[model samples]
Target: MNYKLLGKSGLAVSELCLGTMTFGNTTNEADAIEMIDRFVDRGGNFLDTADVYVSGRSEEIVGKAIKKRRSDIVLATKVRMTTSSNINGVGLSRKHILDGVEASLKRLQTDYIDLYQVHVWDHATPIEETLRTLDDLVTSGKVRYIGCSNFFAWQLMKSLAYSDASRYVRFVSIQPQYSLVSRQMDREMLSLCLEEKVGIIPWAPLGGGFLTGRYTRDEPKEGRMTTKVGESAWINRASDQNFSILDAVVEAAKELDKTPAQIALRWLIQREGITSPIFGASKLEQFEDNMGALGWEMPTEIWNRLNSASALQDDYPNRFIEKFRRPFE
Candidate 1:
C-alpha cells in the first residue's frame, strides 16, 4: 500500500480508502470490524464514512471498529444529508454544520475528524455561511481538514473562490463518482481539481459494481444495482454500450489473470489527480479481492484497451479544439 499527500495538504493517506457504507447495514458489527482489521493489516490507514449512512448506525459501527487504533487512521466523514425530521437537521447552513459535526464526532468517538466534507451542494445556504462554519470547525480543532463531495465543477470553483476571498481554509479534496465505466469526471471536474490542487477521493470507483463483470443483461445479480433498480442511474447503466465496456474489462482480466474488479480499480488508481479510490465490501473475500489491485501493475496494453473502451467522447468546444490541435501535432 502506498500513501500520497492529499492535494496540497501535508497529510498523507493510503491509495485505497476503506469505505464503511455497508457497515451496520449489510454487514454486522463483528463482520465490519473484521473487514477493517484486514484492511489495516494490509497497510490501509484511510477510512471513510458518512453520518447519513445507515441512519448513523454505520458511524457507530465504524467508531467501535476503529476505537482501539483511532490514532493511526485517517478518518473521514461527511455532513449535509438529512439526519432528522427537524427542518434545521440538514443542509450546510451554519446551524446544521455546527450540529452535524458534533453528532459525527460523538458517534465516531473521536475528538477531531481527519477530514470533514459537505456531502452535497446546498444551494439554499449562503456559501459564506457554510464556509465560515467549516472554517470554525477547523479553527476549533474539531476538524483537521475540509472537503466537499458530489459537487459539480462550477459549485466547487465557486466555493474555492469564496474561500479565497474570505481567507477560509480551502477544501483540500473532492469526492465524486468515478470509474472505468463512469468517466464523466474526466470532462471538467478532473481538470478543475488538477488546476486547483484538490485531491480526488472517488466513491463508487467500480460504477456501483457495474465494472465488476458480475452482472449480465438477462439476469442481474442480487447486489447493489439489483437492489436499487428504482434508481435511474442503475437503470440507465444497463445499456449495450456499458455491457460492451464490461466485456472489455473481462477480456483484459482474462488476458492478465486478474479479476475484473482489480483491473477496474488499478486503472482508476493510476489516473492523474486521484488520491484514493473509496471501495466497500460486504464480505471479507470481496475486501481481500480488491486488495489484489495494489500488488502488481496492469500491463500498459490492457490499461489502454480499458481506457479506450470506457472513454467518453469529447464534448462541445473541446471536440472542436481537438480537431484544431491535430494540425499542430
Candidate 2:
C-alpha cells in the first residue's frame, strides 16, 4: 500500500508490484481482470508484465484489465525474450528493441510504458546498440524509465557504463531472482543496485513457491519442483540444510502470527534499498496473503536469524575479504 520512488525516477510505485505472469496462463481473461480489480482495490497501483508471458496473451488481458484506470497505474513490461524463432525476433538488438516495444505498446494499449526493461542479458548484442535504442524510446516518449532483469552484476554495470559514456538512458532498476531461500543477489547485484541507484524489483521472491511450505518435507507437488521442469533441471533434493531453513521460516511465522509466505516477503521488505518485488499469484487468496508483508515488520533479530539460515556462501573477493575483515563476527 506504500509507494516508494522507483530508483532515480520521480515515479512512485506500490510496495508490491502486481505481476501478471499467472494472469492469462492459469486464469481466463475475465478472471485476470477480476484479479487486477481486486488488487487495485487493495491500493496496489504498480503492475509488471512481459511480452513473452503466455505468448503475449498475458499482455492482452493486462491491457484490458487496466483500461478504466490506465493513467492511474505504473505499468511495467519487459522484452528480450524470444517472441519468435527468427533471428531478428529476439534479443536486445536495435531492431528487436524497436519491434518489441511497439508490440508491447500495442498489447498494453498504452502510448507510454511506465518502465521498459530488458528481459534478460543478451550476450550477442553489444551493450551500446541495446542501450542506445532504449535511450531512443525515452526520447520518443515511449518509455518513462528503463530497467534490466535476470542480469548479473557485471552485465548491469557494463550496461550502465555504456549508457553513461553514450549519454543514453541509464537503467533505473534491475530485476533479479531473490528470496529467503535464494540469497544470491545479496552477494553482488544488490550492492551494485544500491551503489548505482537502480531500484530492485525482485521476481520469484518466494523461490518459485518453495518457501510457501506447500512442498513440505514429506510432500512435493507437480507444480514447482516436480514432473515438468524439475524432472529435467532440478533434483528432488531438499537436504537437511534446506529443511532447517524452512523450519526456521515456519517457526518465525508461528511466532509472529503470520503465514510463512508473509514472513518470506517481510524479510525482503526489511532489506535496505529494496523498492518493491513483483510477486506472482495464481489465486486471490495468495495475493491477499502477500499483502500482509507490508502491514508490519519482523523484529531485527528475527530478520537476521532468517537471513543467516538462508544466506548464500560468500564468493570471490568477498570470500577473500571476509578472512581479513571477519564479517560474520
Candidate 3:
C-alpha cells in the first residue's frame, strides 16, 4: 500500500503496480474484473497495460473494469508495437506516434493516459521524431508523462540527451525485466537510471514464476509456468544458474515464514531507485498471493543469502574494470 514518486514527476504511484498483461489473456472477462477489484481493494492505484498486450484485448478489459472509478486508477499504456498492417501502423514515426495514441486512448476509454510509454526502441526512426511527437501529446493534454520500455543503456542515454537539448518531454521511467534470476539490468541500465534519476519499474518481479518455489529441482509441476503443457515450455528454458537460486529462495522463505514470491518481490521492493513493480496474475488467488509481497520486510541475513545464490558472473568490460579497480593511487 506504500507509494513512491514516479521518477521526477509529482505523481505518487503505488509501490506495486497491477499489470494487466494477464487480465484478458490468461483469465476470462469476469475473472479479470474480480482481479481488478482485488487490486483496488488492496489500495493499489497504479495500473499498467500496453496496446499490444493480448492483441489489444487487455486494454478493452481494463478499460471496462475501471469505468466506475476512472480517476482513482493511474492508467499507463505503450506504443511502438505493431497494431496493424498499414505502413503508419507501427514504430515511432511521427505519423505512427500520433496515430497510436489516438487508437490507444479510444481502447482504454480514457481522455488522457497517465503515462504513455514507447514499448520498444524504434531504431529505424529518429529519437527526435519520437520525443517531439510525445511532447506534442503532452501539450495537447493527451498524456501526462512519457516513458520507455526495454531500452538499452545507450539508447536511453541518447534519447535523454536529445530531450535535454530540445527541451521536449523527458522519460520519467524505464520498464525492464528485472528479478532475482535476472541481474542483467544491474550492469549498465540500473546504474544509468540511478544516476539520471529515472524510475525503474521492474517487470517480471517473480522471474516469470521461476522463483515461485513450486517448480523446484525435484517436484516440477505441469501448471507452474505460463504454458499449459510440455517440458521445453519457455518457462523451463531458464538457465541452470537460475534453478540453483530457486533452492536458496525456498530455504530462505521457509526460515522467514514467507513465500519465495514474497521474498523475490521484497528484494526489488527494497532495492534503491525502484519506483514500482508491474505484477500480474492469471487467477484471483494468484493476485492475492502477489499482494502478500507487501506489508513486510525481509531480514538482512536472508537478503544477502538470496543475493549470493543468484549472482551472475561478470562479463567483458565489467570483469576487466573490476580486475584493475584502484583503491588509492
Model 1, runs deviating above 4 Å:
228-233, 324-329
Instruction: Give per-model CA RMSD.
Output: 1.7, 2.5, 2.6
Per-candidate total of colliding backbone pairs: 0, 0, 0
Q: Using TM-score as the measure, what is the rank order of every candidate, best first?
A: 1, 2, 3
lDDT of 1: 0.90
Q: Mind giving the per-residue lDDT tens digits that candidate 3 earns over 205-284?
A: 88777778767554345654646444335444366788878878888888888888888888888888889988888888
- What clash pairs does model 1 have? none
RMSD in Å for model 3: 2.6
Candidate scoring better on lDDT of 2 and 3:
3
TM-score of the candidate numbered 2?
A: 0.94
Residue-level lDDT tens digits of model 1 in 239-264: 88889999999998899899999999
- Report the Cα lDDT for residue 40, model 2: 89
lDDT by candidate, in order shown: 0.90, 0.85, 0.86
Relative to the true structure, candidate 2 has a C-alpha RMSD (angstroms) of 2.5
